[model samples]
Target: MSDTTVTSSSIRNLIKANIRNYSMVLMLALIMIIFSFLTDGVNLNSRNFTNIFMQNSYILLLAVGMVLVIIVGNIDLSVGSVAAFIGAISAMLYNSGANMFVTILLSIILGVLIGAFQGAWIAYAKIPAFIVTLAAQLLFRGLTYIITNVSPISLRDDNFKQIASGMANINVLTINGVYYTALVAGVVVFLIYVVLEIQGRRNKIKYGFKVSPMSFFIIKLLVIGLLIFGLSQRFATYRGIPIVVIVLGVTIIFFSFITNNTVIGRYIYAVGGNARSAKLSGINSELVVFVVQLIMGGLTGLAGVVFTGYMNSALPQAGNNFELDAIAACFIGGASASGGIGTVIGAIVGGLVMAAINNGMSLMNIQAQWQYVVKALVLLLAVFYDIYTRRKTGLG
Candidate 1:
């Protein structure tokens, strides 16, 4: 074959191999377009779209951790209950006139302790995570009720509430009545993303690995950059970028870096890929599992803080079904049910897909029952796709 033909084949194969990496994002965009049309523009309203981010902040946080848990071939059914328990503690502290900082600190420390306890059983004692976390789900839920007396505790601290509802504290500029902070941030991020993409392609080519054609790479970057810019413009017209958006963005970036660049991250993937082999290779699979659970607990604590702030209260039912949403997001975002195959970015896309569906259906006046049915169907399809891909790749 000619050199041109070989290059073309490499690009084609690269696209096929990584199709799932971008599929969920495409689905999310398609869902947004469809809902925009169906809702007569209501679903795409700047406020409504931004609300999706704010509303799903906790689920997104849970998703960041849940993907790691699922990738490790384990589950965390206790996250929602842990969130509720933490929220209750925060509320109790705030109501008792404690400083907001102290309340948050204590809540997170308690969450870490809870994680350590559960991790010990699942990791060291050889208990199944499903059973352990299920027990913890009931245990922490009961504790939430005990703490809150099966009632809601209202929040009165403005600072505490701001974690979920506040906008960025500073604005760079305003042009033609548009806040420029988000737009500027969007541009900066786009530049960084483009640089990284180009660098990745170069590295792949240098290593003789297959890579998408330059044309395809450019197109993908353009679409993604435009999406970010457009979303920022929309938010610019409303409130400045939200504080929760910053939190979520930071979480995604930080975790992405951890999983992609760090030795600990490689160990995690190794453990998930094969615990026995990983242990033999000195990867410390149990330690990875334990640390993952600990991180999940920390994220759950943060979610509790955000959840409480969003509602301005902590109640018995505050975190009901949250763990389910998080897990579904992971599965829908292209995570393998078996383990060792997922991405931080994919989890975010999956969370947004779920959030978009919920927001769009509400805008269309769809009944709650139908919303559940729709989500169930979508999740089923995603898992089926994962299984199909695994089988095709001989991983199943």
Candidate 2:
């Protein structure tokens, strides 16, 4: 074969292999560009960019936990209700003169216990996860109403409210209306990413695995680095990085490490990919499911705290449809319907896609109902893509 033909064939194979990894990112970019034009550039405003993270932080958190649950071949319908209940409890505690830290700790503990309770029924008793979580959803929703007396509990503590609404500007420097601290942080992040990528490539080469061409690798780094730097500059032009963004960032990093680097993470994929085979191989599938539930419950509680802070109150109807948003994000981010095929970063990107859609539609003054219709369509298309890919690969 001619050298040109071989080069073209290799490029085709590379694109085919990496399409799934980059498709959602491209889709997100496309949606942002389209919405920016539709909204006369309002969608790309710096303030609006920050609002995207602040407003959807809780949903993103739920998505992180939900993806893990889905990967374990289960679903937790109760997270929204659980978050509501936990938020209500936290508010009551704060009103009753409890310390803010204490209230937060107790709320998270309560959420963990609730998770364990439901997990026992699903994992040990072998009740269907769907049924158990569904019942808990109703049970907790009712409990929230009872505790809050069907009214909103106003939070008078500004410090507690800052958990979601505050900014973390370091006041180190500024250059042409951009915060230097944020710019520096962005540079640091890019550097770390570069290191990791090089190390990963080196390991692949060491293992005799085919690696991307050096030119393609350099292009990838440049593209991603520019994106990171630009995003930081955007945020710096605004009020600086949000407290919630920091929290969300930490959650993403932690969960990504857990899912990508840990032994339990491997077990989760193994169990989800084939429970029978995992069990036959002496893996404790039940324990994995239970532990995952506990983690989900804890994250749901943390999300509750953040949401309550964002609202500045614990409302009786808080967290409505949150589970739906999280589930949709997981699916849109390329998670498999049959489980065992998702990533933490993908879930976050999926969440950002949902946030962008909601934010952009609102900016364009579209009706809320129409927004729902559009979201439904997007979700359907995402699932269709998943099915198509699976069938194409003969995995379905």
Candidate 3:
């Protein structure tokens, strides 16, 4: 082939490959566009944009842990109940002595214990995860009521409340009568891309597999650019990006890296892909499940702190129905039901998809019932597409 013709063909291939790789992201963008039109741009406001992210952080946190659980061919239906139970305990401690530090530490410890108990049943006892967690849902939820007696508790600690409300200004940027924190975020993202690229290359070489070309890297960088620019503009008119955004950003990077780069992450994936095969391959499936549950419990504890601090109060049902949201987020993020399939970026985007729908509908003053209907349709369609694509590609 002529050099020019060869170059043209390679470019087209790169473009096609990227679109296939990020098909979910494109769908999310389309949804955003539709919402922007319906809301008359209200949903895209810098302040509202920041609000969407902050409001969804708890679900995002849970979804991260849930992704691991689902990847290992199990589900934890108890996280919502567990989170509420812990919050209830925290409230009791607060209501009793108002010792924020002590209460927080106790709650985290409680989370570890709860998670380990459930993990032991599912892993060591050979009980199905769904059943163990379902029982936990009932048990912990009952404890939540017993601990608080159905009374909502208010947090009185000023510093505790500020943990989720405060913003750091060092990264802030003022532009065109607005402020932006993404300039710093942009730098961090670029560095992350470089690190990921180096690691991917190293891994491909280590495994002696063919590495993707620079064109692939270019596409990845371009997507990152779009993300930073779009999100930054959404926050440029506000005071700056909120601290919650930073927290979520860090969480995304850490989890994404851990899952993509670490040995633990691969074991999780292997266990999900095939537990029996993974075990025969010398992977400690038992340890993997245990650690997954351990991390999940810790994350739930963290989410409780965030939700309480953000609201400046802990309700009797502080984490009501959050497990459902996390599950939906994972499924909608393109994870397979049969397990061993998901990405951190996909999981984060899935949360954004939910937030976008919520924010957009609220902006348009749509009734809550209709919002549910619309979201249900979106979720169903995403799953249907996932199954269809996998079958079409013979991935099954």
Candidate 4:
């Protein structure tokens, strides 16, 4: 074949190989477009855009941890209960005149201990994670109710509430009712993304690995940059970026680094890919499982705090079905059912997809039951796609 033909063929193969990674992005965009038309553009409004992030912040946090748990070939069915239990404790502490910082710290510590307890059983005792966490789902949920006496504990602390509901007020620059801080942050993020993409491409080339065509690479960067700026503009038109968004962004960055660049990350994939092989390779699979659970517990605690702050109270049903949402996000975001494959970015995107569906349906006045049906279908299809792709790639 001619050089042009060869280049075109390579591009096609590249796209085909990576379609799974970008499919969720396209799906999210398609869903947003359809919802925008159905809601008469209300779904695309700045206010509603901000609301989606605020409403789904806790689930997104849970998904971050859930993806890790799933990546290690384990599942956490008790995150919802753990979150509620921790939120209840935080509320009680605040009510008893504890400082906000202390309340948050103690709540997270309690969560970590809870995780350690469960992790010990699954990792050291070789108990099935599903069964252990299933029992924990019942255990912590009951504890949540008993501690709160089946009543909601109100959070009177405005500062604590602000964790989920507040906005940054960096008045460094504002013009025409727009916050320039958000825009500046957006530009910085876009620049960092561009730099990283270029560096990654260069490194791949250096390592003699095939890279996408330069034109395709540039286009990818452009699209991502547009998205970054577009979201920032939306937040700028509102009340600046929400504090929860900042928190989520930091968490995403921190975990992304750990997963992408750390040794523990490889251990996780190794254990999930083949426990026996990983153990033979001296990977200490049990330790990896234990650490993964510990991290999940910490994130669940943070989610509990955020959810409580958002509601300004610790309701008895504070985190009902939260585990389902987080797990669904992971599956939809491209996590393999058998584990050893997933990304923090994928989890975030998966979460955004879920958030969009719920928000869109609510905007259209759809019933909650139908929303659940749609989510269930979406999740099923996502897993089906994963299986189909794995088989086609000879990995299944």
Candidate 5:
């Protein structure tokens, strides 16, 4: 009877733990379902579903970076302003008859320059990141107004626009007698995951750490297979996945590797979890912050390119209030404000949730005021759940 009691208690604990971990994802699905019915099933079309990623790619980019910044116990209020500045620069270069290649290179360089400048202020001069980035937000936004004269710069560069507009359908595959591009892409993705898993396990064993549980490994593979297949099917009958989706997927994998596999990543987590202790342990906290910001700036530049290309224009006000969306996405993804906790996967999930909210409400033809109200309420609920879960786990 004691053993039975133990099993029951353990099962209950597992249920609670899972509920806490996956509540946001569950909420996202719930919203999707509610909006699907509300829109008479018009909200989940293959094309419209893919459009969500194209439209919100920049938000995903910014939120990924912001998660790192927030994980390190810092804030960057300047990203929106930086994006606006770079968008103007990109527009100017394209208008000057510069090639798309040159324009992209210049914009990324300028963004890195801005990040280095901010890092110098915060890391070397010892200014608080909040103050430095806040000031930067104002200054860069002001600069954007000056650069573009508050006018919209419509892009006429075909190659540049194609970067955000094109889709990679791969080739069609006969799957159970149905010709499907999703099936093709799904197979490729699953093979890639399998190869990667083997390589990762080999590396772990090479380093002498215990390999992850075989059951866990298989579970991860299954989950990835399902996700890739699901998303591929959703967009299969359309134009396949957008190039922007490819970009977002690469960013997710890249950052996930950074956060999980590198010393810089470890130091980032340490500094965020406890700065003074990390310092005493010989971690260069400031350098970590600087490098992270540098990377953030570069990603912002990339996001700007995609954003402008998708719109076929760059406006001085293109990124208005975008920082809010990015920050909200990060926090909603289970990132702790206190630092040292966040995952690339979580950030993606968070960004998708917000995008779903926007897209679904629009599909339902909800009033603008009600949309805003509903989004605000969802944001509040996500944050509250995060707080409650953390406290319940004694991590708050």
Candidate 6:
């Protein structure tokens, strides 16, 4: 091939490989801008911005686990149902005068058992994940209904309520009506993010891998820093800092580290890429699948707790359609349909995108049916984009 042709081909391939990464972020920004305008700037109001996090917290947690499942070439349609079942259990325990700590622990244990049961059927018995989780979806939902007997379980514990709705106890300062606690937290987080990113780039250089230009890197960090600080300021105006946000931040950091820097993470991608090939390479594909599901279940339990706390009760229908939202977030954030590709950050952005759309539409008094249609179209387009890119790169 001519040098010019070769250069053009390489550029095209690069774009195909990474377009989703850029597009997801840009799409979120675009959505925020559009919704801000559509809602007459109501969407960007301090209270509304905080509501976005509080409302979508559980979904984000589910999306974190969902992305990992997708990366391993599996799906867990039962997450929402499992969450509801666990939440129901927690509510019953709380109402029975059980200690909040004990209630949480038992709920998580229930989640583990449920995940292990489904994982065994799918991984050990050689059943398809779709069938196993689909069955689980019905089973768990039915269990939730049976346990609650079609009634909502109310929680009247103040300590339990703080799990999702409480603010941070720390106070940095109160300056000109802006709570400095949020800003300080944002600054600390931004510094940590920047340091880790720069260190990662250095490691890439040390390993003889390609790296982005310093200019590009700096600009990217600046943009992300501003976004972090900007949102923190907004959050400060409402509540100093939400406890759930702190929980989410910690979870994201931990999972992001594991997926990028751990051996098990590589095995997950390998199995997803080709399970048979991975097994032949001496990787225990079944064990990996089993462990992934177990982790997913634990996270689902955590989500259940947060969600239950958020509503101050657990209704039989509380988690209805939550799985769909989590799955959509993964795909929309750029997870490959056939698996072996995704990121923690992408899933967060995708969930935020979904949350933004839902929140914005509700603010405008749009009907539920139309909201569903719009979200369905958006999810379809996102999957289509994934397929188009994969085919272009001959990976489909």
Best by lDDT: 4
Off by over 4 Å in 1: 1-5, 195-210
Give the alpha carbon lDDT tens digit for every residue of 1-396 in model 3.
699898787776555434424787887899788988887877767788778877888889889888888889999999988888787667667767857678777777778888899999999999999999999999988887887778877766666665466665654466676665665666667777777878888988899965557777776777777788777766665656666677777878898889988999999999999999999999999999998998888778777877877777767677777988888888888887789988777777887888888888888889999988988888898778777767765667
lDDT of each: 0.89, 0.89, 0.80, 0.91, 0.82, 0.89
- lDDT digits (tens) for residues 1-396 of candidate 2: 699999999998887666666799899999999998999998898899988988999999999999999999999899999999999989888888998789888988988899899989998999999999999999999999999999999986777778788888563577777777877878887887788679768967997989989999999899889888888888888877787887887888788868865789989999989999999999999999999999999899999999998999999999999999999999999888898889888898899999999999999889999999999999999899988977875667
State the lDDT at 126 in candidate 4: 90
Q: Assess every candidate by TM-score.
A: 0.95, 0.94, 0.90, 0.96, 0.89, 0.94
Between which residue pairs do clashes occur in model 2?
A: none
**Candidate 4 lDDT by residue in tens digits, 1-396:** 699898888877788778778899889999999999999999998999999999999999999999999998999999999999999888888889998789878888888899999999999999999999999999999998899899999876677888898996663588888888999999987887777677767867897989887888888888888889999999999888898999898899789878865789889989989889999999999999999999999999999999999999999888999999999999999999898888888999999999999999999999999999999999999999999988876779
The number of clashing residue pairs in each candidate reads: 0, 0, 0, 0, 0, 0
Give one digit per residue, the lDDT tens place, for model 5 in 1-396: 999998677656655655554666767778788888888887778778878888899989999898998899988899998998998889888888999889888888888888899988988799999999999999999998998888888776566777677775453454553438666767886797688778878888998966545765787678768878878887676776677777787888788888877888889899899988999999998899899889888888887887788878887887877888888888888888789887777777888898998998887678989988877887788788788887887778
Q: Report each candidate's C-alpha RMSD, comma-separated, in the order given.
A: 1.9, 1.9, 2.9, 1.6, 3.1, 2.3
Cα error of candidate 3 at position 353, Å: 0.5
Candidate 6 overall lDDT versus native: 0.89
Let me know the TM-score candidate 2 reaches against the reference structure.
Answer: 0.94
Over 62-123, each residue of candidate 6 has an lDDT whose tens digit, in order, gives: 99999999999999899999999999999888888889789888888888888899889988
Worst 10 residues of 5 by lDDT: 170-179
Error of 6 at 206 (Å): 3.5
Return the candidate ranking by TM-score, descending. 4, 1, 2, 6, 3, 5
What is the overall TM-score of model 3 with all chains considered together? 0.90
Which tens-of-lDDT digit does each residue in 1-396 have in candidate 1?
Answer: 699898877776666677788889989999999998999988887788788999999999999999999988999999999999999898888888988788878888888888999999999999999999999999999999998899998877677778898887866587776788989989987887788678767866897976666788888999998888988988898887898998888888788778875788888888888999999997889999999999898899989989999999998888889999999999999889999999888999999999999999998889999999999999999999998877775668
